[model samples]
Target: MATDDEDKVLLAVCDVIKGSTLLKAGRSGKPHFRQFKLSNDLSRLMWESAKKMDAAVLISQITEIKTGQVTPVFLKNPIPQCEAVSFSLLYSDRSLDIVCKDKKEFDTWTTALKALIVDKYDNKEAVSAKLVEMRGSIVSEDRLEVQLGTIKTKVLLKDNSCDLYLWGGGDRGRLGHKDDKPRFLPNVVESLLGQNVTMIACGGSHTIALNSKGQVFSWGAGPQGCLGHGNLRDRYSPLMIDGPLRDVNVVHVACYENHSAVISEDGNLYTWGKAGPFLGYMDDSVTKQTKPRLVDALYGTRIVQVACGRSHTLVIDEEGRVYSFGINKFGELGQGHDKAITKPTMVPNLVSICKVSCGRHHSAAIDEDGVLFMWGWGARGQLGQGEPKSLFSPTPVNGFNDQPLEDVSCGYGHTAAITANGVAYCWGDNASSQCGVPSSVYGELSSPRGIVLPSGIRPTQINCGANFTVLVTSIGQLFTWGCNMSGQLGNGEAKKTFSQPMPVESLSEKRVKMVACGEDHIGCLVGHGWVPDEEVKSCMACKKSFTAIRRRHHCRQCGGIFCGSCSTKRYPLLDKGHADPVRVCDKCYVSLSSSSNIK
Candidate 1:
């Protein structure tokens, strides 16, 4: 009797091959073998006659078959100089001899015939039921959750789970765990262990979380009333922000520098914290809004998306019209003026917009035609317009006109976009390697250039932090480049930079669904099957033993284990995802510095 595993293999092979093959025409008076192809449903096999040609055989019409038949061969030496397995396929009207390359091939054909016989008369319904069960099981394993923080720390939150994990910097209650102690490894937020948190966002020194019920929670530095609790008080633990927003079903939230914004399901937008002219209010009477307040100017317009810059805000309505209100020191508002706009004013000449992104001092947008528009600070070429001059109004990025972008993102001083074909393009500051290019080529890219990756690696999503970039591929693989000062790349290293995209090996086993970045930290959502690595006891490069004094360190560039002595060098690495100088091992230092030709 065949084992269950063998039976499964046979069933799979039969389902894919289905016994379709080339057969010589005997009674049809043709010298050529006719090719038969299976229909998509596998119910029938169609073939063309050798002369007039066009015939088909239905699997349901196949009768009993005999194997190893040598008498009454259809053609003499069907395959020249090769041994072939012959069998008789009995149909309702006639019998035909089928020749195969070998016994293995003959067995495959026989197995498919047997399966079709059984399926046609005995187990068709049973097999269909089993397939449905298998499909359900596969779908159950697909749910995933991803979270990201800044260079100072990291966070991880899984879907359908209530626990929020935090690591790295814990200053000013940014970790949301009621303490200021940094966590070198992931630690659960005991307070939110069963709260069923759904989303998380991080800023310079603050954290915000949204639960399944749309309730908003915030913590950390509130110097500018970023907490949205109606006061400039810092909370060491997660505190629910309730009041006007309590009854609203908030769907999305974003944070920048000392400001925060939330959008409700009904298309309403609320903002708080560091309320200068940037929060859509021009009144000098209010410089800070400790509580979430509705933008009166956008009272009737339904906002579909919102993004925040350091001191500015951008909103898109249901009609694809863009509105900007905030500081315009570098023309970030794209309003043809350098002065601040106290109201949500329409960004002129921008229509059919589909997506928008904001950097610390610049903004980017993509339209229905896949055209990219950029404005604001361009000193480092973040605008991608072939120059470092700032734009006071929305200007089309002509370089990408031929590329047809699908998505675009902006970093503090760089910009990245993905074309419809999944190719990634980046431009702007290479000072810290943020542009994924060498500074020796050009300190800043005045125009967009392609970012090369290994074959078969196609980016599905891209995001930029203060100085680093993160990408997630179609197969759920995560890659990071630019600066790595705070281990934001999640590569387990602390190298100064990576001039190219490198896989985050720690997440090799886990299916990463989402990733977010901050100035010094990263957060990711992954499937439930992830396994943590054991602690390293030796340097990955020199094999030096690690002691209490000789602590274990990680190379930011390669994400390898290293000792303090082996990882003591620091370099201004923008490509490894850092905005400043970061410590790296000697190997990475030499490679990164030599590539850029910086002594």
Candidate 2:
């Protein structure tokens, strides 16, 4: 991502700075100058003199990179009495302020520190890239990788043997049937049979798919070659993406309205389509990458995941740090400034962001601790901050102290989330009844409200689309509400709108493992060549409801849904047409234990 000279400067940031003053409130500490060195592996930042090791903080321990004096000590001492070019390092519990010798040195130290936090770039590249510092006056830089709402596929599901299904608007070749006819119900994509497709991303008009072999396929109406077929022509059948993606194992793919990107298993990122700055391209001559091209700027970084809004894109690295690029007019980048940039700039102050979702303008991310944060456009209260106000930085959604959220989805103007306990909440624009609330309830919600679901409808995954919502239960049931203009609800209707959650009866026959939402279309991935999730709706013996945490188990012997208590034992049954654990049910466990043929 940087030249050798810049890498050296970033790796060799040896400096002495005036420290102190900026501790937590009610703490006492004196200011002093100390020499500091970044560890060779760039894992730790250590400071000391010739005699003693003052302190050593893991680079990952620093939660935020801040600028200027902000502590009570600095309030009393004032900037006139201290170094004006100073920055602060905020950890989980404490903060350390360091003052540099001059403006150049201050920029160098701050840039190096921010880049090292994301584990990329150096001071010069950071400056050129415009770092995302929290301070209002300071600028931020970028490293590019982005995921779109089209493919905000969570990693919670690892099963890859899934069949592809599609419904809704077939215009622009979205249904992948080589025709522009609408599918009013869930129908299997016969062409994708036996492909073992693991994931699917439904974009505004195009669709991208990835199979178990790491092959990526795309079709539908592509803007600026988003389909990656070397031209802007729309495709009706899934075509394996080649060009720069040829022979590359694409682990992840994201698509919004007009752009698309993918992360290779080897940690390399490739992007196509049209996103002026958000596309993370260094070249200024090319307006659109008609073919998928490797993003040279973020070449070596390990991007774990990505999400994209209408025009902006956010990428998360292996360290769980957040980075953003593209348009920031509404502060979707969470860089504390609205200026758009072309590189992947670190989103400061956010720690261990594990999941991210992008709406038409807003963005949401969940930390490892399960706290949900929202930023960007909030004119419709999509930020869920109890008010319609845009946030330049990531802000935690209140009222979730007890139960953390496990899944989140952002739509054109609405948002949805699922708690760890299976509770679903919706907030933001309800004008089209997309917020899971009837139009009588209000045009928009300022805060999240529990969605009134039908009996036995506990959601394990929640997804939002242009003007509709999709929820998947533990048993593979799918319920939809809001806009059905294109028969996206999969209920054999095209002109109706739903204010309450309605089951897509056509999908009740199979087990839905994953779902993707496009502007007016839908894509589903179901468990293939196995017992459908629908068959395991309840425990065969107890008949209890299944939730996100209280999962339904399958009996290895009879293949019936059983509670954990019923299938507590595992026994080999290779002789009975099974290889691994053939008899796990209570009866099978007891019988296998008594059988001398168990060998």
Candidate 3:
């Protein structure tokens, strides 16, 4: 319960002198200056209270006094009158005159007024708390980790305590906790409560986490050695991987559909799981990497970054050289041939690369010169070449030759980039509004188009999920658009899609330092003081009590708390990038089913 007085606290103050006046046009069409006297309190002045002359207003509410002028009056006597500075403050339907003894006083008063306005109105306790929370959240310099499986999950790491939190579907132990128990709110992974987990990556049915000591741990589905435990065995809890990577200090990890890759502190790369002919293997003789194996071909190359597509792997070396392996069905290998490579091979015609990104079947890279090169599948215009033609080799993206790009990201069928000038651009598939285009024109965008954002908003980093895009601005503001069926946009809504970028209001109180998007989930690392949603004791849809056997569930479509009975149905939420069946509440199921029929 807040009172109006609490909300209308003193926001600003100014020092002033007598005999100075502010002039503005009156209703009679005549310009006039009102005289006033200064009180003992520098913040206060003596004026007609009946005219609401003492009403306090925020500095932002003050309109610029462009037409009004301030005048100082001097006495023509034997002794010259002291000089005075005059300024004007305009409010809605009213104007104010402020006079200071000298120029120094005027400047001091203006600064004080502006500073107090921000301190009193913008610096609320709630905002401060959120900032504190964001600072403690786990995040890379500009990348926030978010994942979407049947459920949405995020990881938060503190100084010495790493906690894995999950909500939504909990099937197959994907949540890394009790099996079959879905969570509606964030629930900590008890096994990793005390460990210093620094990084986390997710596959279709598995999860992998890395700690500060360079130790790797994994859980969930293990078929095809996706869990990297030296055997295709699933673990309900976190298990430290102690195979060939035990002696090495792992710094980064990436997980695809059925395989994983890790980078060590020494810039060495290790890959394992689901090895097949399409993944650069000469034959299908070996289909599973039960243990981590070194990439022999990259022995002399020091890799700095790694990205994984649905079935292929891309790595960048210290010298900005690109190396790729795996399937080339859609030219994802960028090897000038549609044939798959069985080993790590240098990508021809690409060098000085600073960043690399992989999509479901396409690949993109940014060179030192800020040029963006893309290749592979382009049926949806992902190549940004003004046509839907697949390429076996890297091709420079058109239309950005003069504007250097700072960063770029690739989604399932689209591409996004941020220019050095802080403009955001997107191209390719917009079927789900992923390209930030209107839904009525939900087709391919052959060339990059600047994403219209609110005035003054400048994007610094950008990332794309399967069918959605998230970006952060230099001011720490986050904007999200595209599929919102799973609340991945973090607007706390279940709308099917957003055709334009919208601010994430839920994080307005805190500063968003990093953001990561997965197939259907989004994670954010904010500054301190964020309070997570409370765990509901009863189902949100049916309002049923929870018991020992009656487990809780979450609607992937709406992010609502529910009971198993209320969320028993499953559907392919295309807008959320779930092409396979995923859990949905009865309400969403009914709405989606009806909409499908209408379409």
Candidate 4:
């Protein structure tokens, strides 16, 4: 008969492994007296239970026989001759016995014991029931990562390769890489590694990038000190600007010409960049600030958003208060006075402002009650007010009779918006067919016109570039319209312009995460192509034109451009070259011949 400890192992291991292996002994006595062997370490109580409880009576009343010569009836394996085993007695805490066991038997017993403990301790349903109770609690230590823009279709192409489409690469530092170079293909931008970015916006040559952390990074032309770096120096990399910004986290940022504005988490407004009399409170001492300055006039009240025009700013507060400031030369401020405001000033009777967007020379806003408002230069009906020319203050654009607005975006001289369900509409100058309205359908639209999309295309997000419009679909497709010069559409070719949205070719696989547009350049974040490889290419940092010409025989050392006669030393790194159409001067050729072999 097996001891109590051996009985437990057989109970657990036999059930778990399901008879894969076994331990049995030949009986030597009628009582099946097989010499019991326990592991080197067994609970004293267990051994004592077996020894003192009439299972075995010993001279010392020892519970377990330690290093003892127990006569073996049946041994699982050859027992170790010298190892000691601790023993305990039943109903006693002070006495113990030693019994020896084989090393293999010891290991098997240990495994079985652990399985038995787990079976005894775990209650499956009880754990599941407790987890369900915690699900209702809302306080989460982790925050949700949200983004605003959709991916561009032409951001990546087939074969897992990159083709960066870069234009306006000269000025705003928009390329985010080396300047003084024109990048024709959409190349990989390696600076955003490990960063979770949500939105990107560009104004002329300046750019503003917002990450999930609520921190804003900007670069590009800063002459108007539009970069907010506090100084006028141009920035090549995205750098954070210091300000009074905090928990009232920033959600959206916009820049126009040389000015920038941002909407905070709490809906307060902040403006910086060129400040003129039209901003209100006109005074020589306080007009302009290169850094961000809070619009204290609307501080206490929550303002939903702000938009910037070429020289003016428009803000709509939570209670539907429309505020206008800055250059009103075209009467875009809409204060009804035809004068610019140097500080925040309320626009007379504006109410229920749901959304507001600005163009190069005009401003448009929609009320919560679904009424469209227009002011300033309405040239070619960008104001959707039926007539061209200026409207000094807030005037309702006739046609929306009673339709509510969901969102809005402004272009250089036009505007576009989407309804709650997915219908897109546009008004304003369709000069490059950016409005998606047929070119033959001329003149300004006094009312909103529907944009016809391809049969199955539904836009997830929409963006307006200088004179173009980009639409991103929920299924990761990108379609673009308007001026395609410089291949801004990423279709591998440039067109004078397109009248309707056209699908970008070959990209249905790469997942584009985000896109940003400058005056003539486009930036996008693409996935899955950062693998490493080695290839010899021209250095972006050096002048390629200077190294194009070669010398047949020049000193390999010092790069003196002298013949072999003058070169005493041979340096192969700089000396190796090809002999092309023209023969190199003997003096220059001989200079490179010394020490280095002509290849």
In terms of lDDT, model 4 sits at 0.54
Q: Best to worst by lDDT, what's the order? A: 2, 1, 3, 4
Poorly placed runs, candidate 3 (over 4 Å): 1-197, 233-239, 277-285, 493-495, 526-599
lDDT of 1 by residue, 1-599 (tens): 75654565445443433333333426434223334444445577565553465576777777766665443454443322122355666677676665443344455666666566555423445446545555533231221121112323111122433435554456788777688765543444545533446666777778777765577888888888999998888888889899979788787788878689988877889989986877775576777899998887888798988888898999999999999999899999999999988888999999999999899999999999899999999998889888888899999997654878888888889998999888888999888777888666667898998888999998888888788888889987888888776666666656687778888775676566666565665555554331122545576567778787978766654455578888888754322224234676777676555534311
- Candidate 3 colliding pairs, count: 19
* Residue-wise C-alpha lDDT for candidate 2, range 210-309, written one tens digit per residue: 9866789998986567888888888988888877776787888888887888888767888788747878885566776788888777877889897877
Local distance difference test, per candidate?
0.70, 0.74, 0.66, 0.54
Candidate 3 on 330-399: residue-level lDDT in tens?
Answer: 8899998888777888899998999998888999999999999999999999889998889888999867
TM-score of 4: 0.57
Model 4, span 1-599: residue lDDT tens:
64655445544343222211111212332111112322212221122122345232322233332222233422322222212221122223332222212223333443443433333323334323433544453122221122212311111011211222233344646665545344544544334332335566677777776754466777778778778778777776667666655344687787777688777876777777765643333455654667876777667777777777788888877788888888788888888766667778888878878778777878888777666777888776777766666788878765433455565666776767666566777777787787887656754464567788988776656667777777766676766777777567666666577878777653455555555566666665444333222211222122122223421232221112322233333221210111111223333334333312211
Superpose all Cα atoms of candidate 3 onto the true structure and report the RMSD in Å to 1 decimal. 21.8
- State every prediction's TM-score relative to the real structure: 0.60, 0.63, 0.58, 0.57
Model 2 scores a TM of: 0.63
Instruction: Show model 2 residue runs off by greater than 4 Å.
Output: 1-158, 530-599
Error of 3 at 357 (Å): 0.6
lDDT for model 2 comes to 0.74
Greater TM-score among 2 and 4 belongs to 2
Steric clashes per prediction:
45, 15, 19, 41
Query: How far in Å is the alpha carbon of 36 misplaced in model 1?
Result: 44
